[model samples]
Target: MAKEKIVLAYSGGLDTSVILKWLKETYDAEIIAFTADIGQKDELDGLEAKALSTGASKVYIDDLREEFARDFIYPMFQSGALYEGQYLLGTSIARPLIAKRMVEIARAEGATAIAHGATGKGNDQVRFELTAAALAPELGVIAPWRMDEFREQFPGRAEMIAYAEKHNIPVQASAAKPYSTDRNLLHISFESGMLEDPWFDPSATSNEEMYVLSVSPEEAPDQAEYVELEFEQGNCVGVNGEAMIPLEIMEKLNELGGKHGVGRVDMVENRFVGMKSRGVYETPGGTILFAAHRKMESLTMDREVMNLRDSLNARYSSLVYNGFWFAPERLALQALVTESQKNVSGTVRVKLYKGNVIGAGVKSHVSLYNPDIATMEADPTKAYNQNDATGFIRLNALRLKVASGVEQNAKK
Candidate 1:
């Protein structure tokens, strides 16, 4: 009988690399290693060779940068979803996309199971498994970190390192840095290690080694910089009047935002598995986009509609954070979010200075801002009638007056 085929979500990192070898030895399965390239910069360098050398039967690396920004990031941004009112949902958002692609690969390769390196204690395991279950219910999901056999054999990173050494596997991990990191186009996140302490400040070092996408606010240039963003139906399409593709737009914004030290967040966030984790994130471009997008919406969106969407922002963000990206509820909410963006086309000017993304100006052709009626200066031919306010105030105040009278009667 042929050995079972397993598709592994390989990141070329120490954990996933060790998992790849362990899976082969324990399951006696053929491992097809998969890596999703979502703008991790130099992290993808030599990944293919490394996977192939580490007992992978085949190595697949796909560049999903454009799809990631256009499909996942933009729709989530449209909802203005922020996990726990702070995190950009960078790591949370990427999991679904990775899982979706892994499922497709599994089906194509006739694989029976998909494996991930997410630890049992962390949220990524839930994210990866939920997505796989939603997309491919028949496929078996394997989590090495959750397996007792795997844990007993390799209790910690030290044992894993020793195993790698014994098996002659090449790994870049070292005891010097005990933290884990996840990176993509939107942001780079650091957790564990010294960052595990909520009060620990990574910026104490002059190098600011923890940050990959932006500089420290104190180290940023003294002068502020301005940039213009153009949006069409709530999607950022151009930067500084230059029309660019989704990937190019992110690249440019990341550069500009990073130079000005924009988009750095540190917080202890609630994980879906009921634990608090301290994370430091650098989301330079995403910060600019979020600020500029909201500014543009202020001019173009209807008041009531904006309020309704804002009310659901927390629910929408929780759905994303909890690995429900492919859930029907999330899709339904996304549809409403998309519908709300139909009129959200405009330009927003932003000032970037010392980790701040400040909106300078916003304009839209379909703007509801009627300056003629709203002007403070008296206009003889203003559209708004001054006499209209008397009746409006009287009618609105009647309910309050009646309630007061009822209260006085009860007291008597």
Candidate 2:
């Protein structure tokens, strides 16, 4: 009988490289390492050679950038989903797509099980497993972090490093730089090292070499530069009036926003596991998208509808943050959000300078902003209903009048 095979999501990182080697030894089964290139352009370099050298029977590196941006990013963008008030839900949205593909590869390769390096404590574990549960219920999930045997053998990063050394498995990182980081096209997250301290100010030190995706805000251009974002059904289609594809639009916005230091956030956020964790994120294009989409909604969406959705946006964000992406309630909220964006087709001009995204103007074919009804210059005689104010005010003030009458009677 053929040995049972497990397809592991490999990143060629320390944990994953060690996991790849450990899985083969412990399971005594064929291990196929898979890497998804979802906009982690430079990070994917040498992944194939690294996986193979780390004791993988086979390696697959799939570039899911276009699909990532178009399918996952665009739909979340449509919902205007922000994990917190500040976070753009970057990591939350990428997991399902990657896991979906993982299941696909598992079936294609005849692998009985799929594995990931996500630790049991983090949101990634939930995201990956929930997606697997949703998409491929039949495939067994091998999460080494949750396994007692794996944890006993490799208690932490130090143990993993020792095991890697003992097994001759090559890892790009050492025990010195022990910070855990996840990167993709949408954004990159840094956590679990020197960052665990809540009071740790990432911006306090002038570590010019450490910053990526943007320059220091002090170095941003003095003058604000305006860019127009065009969207159709909430999916960004163009920048500054020139039509472009999804990835192209993102690249353009990142270039423009990063040049102006438009997207950089550091916060201590509540993790799904009831623990608060500090994170530093740079979401240049996503920042631009949020600004432009908000401006567009201000002009296009109905006041009550917008208010209703805005009220629920926090709950929606909490669901996404808490790893409820596959939940039915989230889907229902998403459907409502999608319905809200049907009229959210428009262009919004934003001024970016020194990390500030100011709304300059907004225009949409579906816009509810009627200049005729709003303009101060409009003729007062015909459209104005100044005479109706007396009855309107009297009716509105009845409750107050009744309360005042009762007070007056008591005083008398």
Candidate 3:
């Protein structure tokens, strides 16, 4: 009988390199490695060659930066999806896209199962598996980390390193390295290892070098720089008056935001698996865009509509963080959120100074903020009459008055 064919979401990282070799040796199966280039920069350089020499049948490397930025990042931003009011959902958002592409590769390669290097404890496993369950339920998921046989053979990094050396698989991880990083167009996240210590500051001393996307705040230029962000229907379309595609926009924002040391977050976040994990992230471009987008909405969005969306944004963010990018409820939220952005088109000026994105100004053709009716000085335009406020206040205060009277009667 022919050996079973499996497609592995390979990153050419320490864990994946060992998993690739083990899959071939243990299962006696043909393994195809797929690496998605979603803005890891130098990390993608030798992935294809490395996978082949380690015993994979073939390797697939594709540039998904544009798709990632346009489809995943932009739509999520429309709802202003920020997990727990802080996280930009960078790693959380990228997993489903990677898994979706992996499923596609598996189908095209005529593979029986899909596999990933995500450990059982981490959220990535659920992300990868849930995407598979949602997209291709027929394709079996093989998680070697959860398998007792594989775990016993390679209990930790030392055993994996020994196995890689024994099998001649190339990996750059050392036993002493203290953290793992995941990078994409939107952001780069560092977690595990020494980062497990919630009290540890990754920005201190040599750890500062761990930041790849942005500089430390202390090192940023003293002079604040201003940039204008232009949006069309809630999606950031350009920067500094230049129209750009999704990739160009992100690249430009990343460059500017990094130079200003904007968007470094260190926090212990609650993971879906019922534990808190400390992570340090650099999301320069995403932070800039998110700030500018909200400023633009302030000019064009309706008050009640904005409030209602804000109430649901937390739920929307949770859905994205929990790997429900393809779920029905998230889709429904996206639809409602996108509708709210119909008039959210404008330019927002932001000052980037020492890791802060300060709102400078905002203007829109359809802005609800009318100076004629809002100015306290005079009624030159007669747009709003002050006399109308008497009835408005009385009507609104009627319930309060009645409640006060009822309280007094009860006391008596």
Candidate 4:
């Protein structure tokens, strides 16, 4: 009988590389390695050769940058989803896209199972498995870190390194660099290892190496830089008046934002698995977009509509963080978000300097901001009457006056 086949989400990293070899030896399974190119920059270099040398039967690398930004990143950004008001949900958002591709590959290759290198303790495992279950429940999901047998065989990074050495797997991972990192077009995140200590200050010289997509705020140029962003129906369409594709827009913003030391966040965030993790992230492009998008909305969106959307921002963000991208609630919420963006078309100028994204100016053809009524200087012909404030304030103060009288009676 032919050996059972399994599709492994391979990143050519230390953990995944070791998993590839271990799966082959332990299960006697044919390993089909799949790597999704979601803008990992130089990380993809020599990935195919390394996977095949490490014991993969057939390796596949697909470029999903455009798809990732257009479908996953853009929609999440449109909803203004931020996990705990800090993280942009970078790694969290990428997992579903990766899982979706892994499922497709498994079906195509006639594989019976799909495997990932996410540890049992982290949120990625949940994200990957939930996506798999939602998309292809019939396929077996294999998580080595969660299994007792796999954990006993390789207790930690040291044991995994030893196994890799024995199996002749070529990997650059070492015990010296304890922290692990995940990177993509959206952001780069660092956690575990040295970052575990919540009191540890990463601003020290030792932690300088953790940053990849941005520079230190002190190192940024003294002068501020300004950039204009164009949006159509809540999607960024151009930068500095230059029209570009989704991928190109991200690349441009990342370069500009990185140079100005924008988008650096450090916080202890609550993971879906009932634990809090300290993580440092660099999300240059995302930060720029977030600020610019809000500025555009201020100009174009109505006050109450924006407030209603803001009320649901936390719930929307929670759904994304908890790996509910395919869930029904998220889809329904997205519909409302999309509807709210129908008139959110305009250009916003943002000033970037020393880790700050400040709004400079914003304008829209359908802007609701009326200078005639809002200006401090009284306008004789303006529709807004200053006399109307008397009745409005009196009516609003009625409830407070009644409550004060009731309190006095109780004291008496």
lDDT of each: 0.92, 0.83, 0.92, 0.92
Better of 2 and 3 by lDDT: 3
TM-score of each: 0.97, 0.92, 0.97, 0.97
| Model 2 lDDT per residue over 1-412, tens place | 9999999998888889988988998899999998888888788888888888888889989988888888878767766667667899888888888888899999998999999999888888888888888778999999999999999988777787788888787776754554666777777777777778867666665444445788767888998899999988777889988999888887888888889987888888888877777888888888988888878888888998888888887888777776677778888988888888888888889999898889888888888877766667855445656678899999999999999999999999
**Residue by residue across 1-412, what tens digits does model 4's lDDT show?**
9889999999998899999998998899999999999999899999999999988999999999999999999999888888898999999999999999999999999999999999988999988888898899999999999999999988877888888888888778876778899999999999888789898888676778768999889999999999999999999999999999889999999999999889999999999999998999999999999989988988898888899999999999988888888888999999999999999999999999999999999999989888877888987557888899999999999999999999999999
Give the TM-score (vs. native) of candidate 3.
Answer: 0.97
User: Against the hidden true structure, what lDDT does model 2 obtain?
Assistant: 0.83
Kindly indicate the candidate among 1 and 2 with the higher TM-score.
1
Give lDDT tens digits, candidate 3, residues 344-380: 9989999999999999999998899988778888968
Candidate 3 error regions (>4 Å): none
Model 3 whole-model lDDT (C-alpha atoms): 0.92
RMSD of each: 1.5, 2.5, 1.3, 1.3
